[model samples]
Target: MSVLTTKEIMDIIPHRHPFLLVDTIEELVPGVRAAGKKCVTYDEYYFRGHFPQEPVMPGVLIIEALAQVGAVCILSCEKFKGKTAYFGGINNCRFKKKVVPGDVLMLETELIKQKGPVAIARATATVDGKVAATAELTVAIG
Candidate 1:
């Protein structure tokens, strides 16, 4: 069961079409953790320019997707409601595999720590149970 639909996710995050990478929130614990999904398709706008022959989902976008999931976890909390989570920094980021069309990216983020308006989360993006990307993200809620 989905914890939040695309429409509901839109209400929580400011991202819109072409940029909103998260398709559904499968699991969520406000201010703690979140698990989301993004189904990469051949029709994605990025595919047009990212690579005409062998299209692959950009690594930066994969990080962005993970960040969006972290945002949902933080912004959904009553204390942080209506606030935006900005990327303060990214650390230990590593891309392990290529994500391409027809892949369903499973994104997960766990809020590991927080100080004032700043928070840190361990994030990961996986495809078919294989790690595609991993990072420690620092976010500032404002």
Candidate 2:
């Protein structure tokens, strides 16, 4: 079950189709943490040109998905509602596994430090209980 549907998520974050990587928000604690999922498919836009014989989800997009989850965590707070969370930086990013089509990617982000308009989030992406990627994301609320 989803605490926030795709439609509802759009209300909190400024992401749309194709670019809207996150499908559902499973758990949310405003300004603190969030968990979301992305249902990867073979027909995804980038899969076409990325490789016809073998399609792999782009690492950057996976990182973006993690950022979107982090955005939801930050923007859902009452004070930050209707705002956009922009990436200040990404650090210590590591890709451990390739995310392929048909994989249900689970994304989680936890706010590690926050002060005023900037914050740091620890994010991770996984599939079938296996790690795919991890990063330390810095964000600025706008």
Candidate 3:
């Protein structure tokens, strides 16, 4: 079961179709953590040019998905509601596996630190229980 559908996620984040990566949020704790999923399909816009022969989900997009999950966590808070979370920075990022069509990317992010309008989170993306990517993200709310 999902805690937030794509529509609900859109209500929280300022992302639209062809750019919004997360399909469903399964778990969430305002200002703390979130878990979401993205179903990879061959029809995704990026696949059209990213490698016509053997399409692969972009590594940056994996991090963006994680950031979006973190944004949902932060933006859902009473104080931060209606605010935008900008990417302050990305640290210690690593990609372990290639995500492809038919893969369900399971994304998780935990808010590790926050000060004033800036925050940090530990993020990870997986497919079939295997790590696809991991990173530390810095976000600034405005």
RMSD to truth, every model: 0.6, 0.5, 0.5
Assess candidate 3 and give its TM-score to the true structure: 0.99
Candidate 1 C-alpha lDDT tens digits along 4-49: 9999999999999989999999999998999999999999999999
Model 1: CA > 4 A from native:
none
Candidates' C-alpha lDDT: 0.97, 0.96, 0.96
Which residue segments of model 3 deviate by more than 4 Å? none
Candidate 2 on 1-142: residue-level lDDT in tens? 9999999999998899989999999999999999999999998999997777889999999999999999999999999999899999999999999999999999999999999989999999999999999999999999
TM-score of 1: 0.98
User: What is the C-alpha lDDT profile of model 3 across 3-57, one tens digit per residue?
Assistant: 9999999999999988899999999999999999999999999999888999999
Ranking by lDDT: 1, 3, 2
**Candidate 1: 10-residue stretch with minimal lDDT:** 76-85
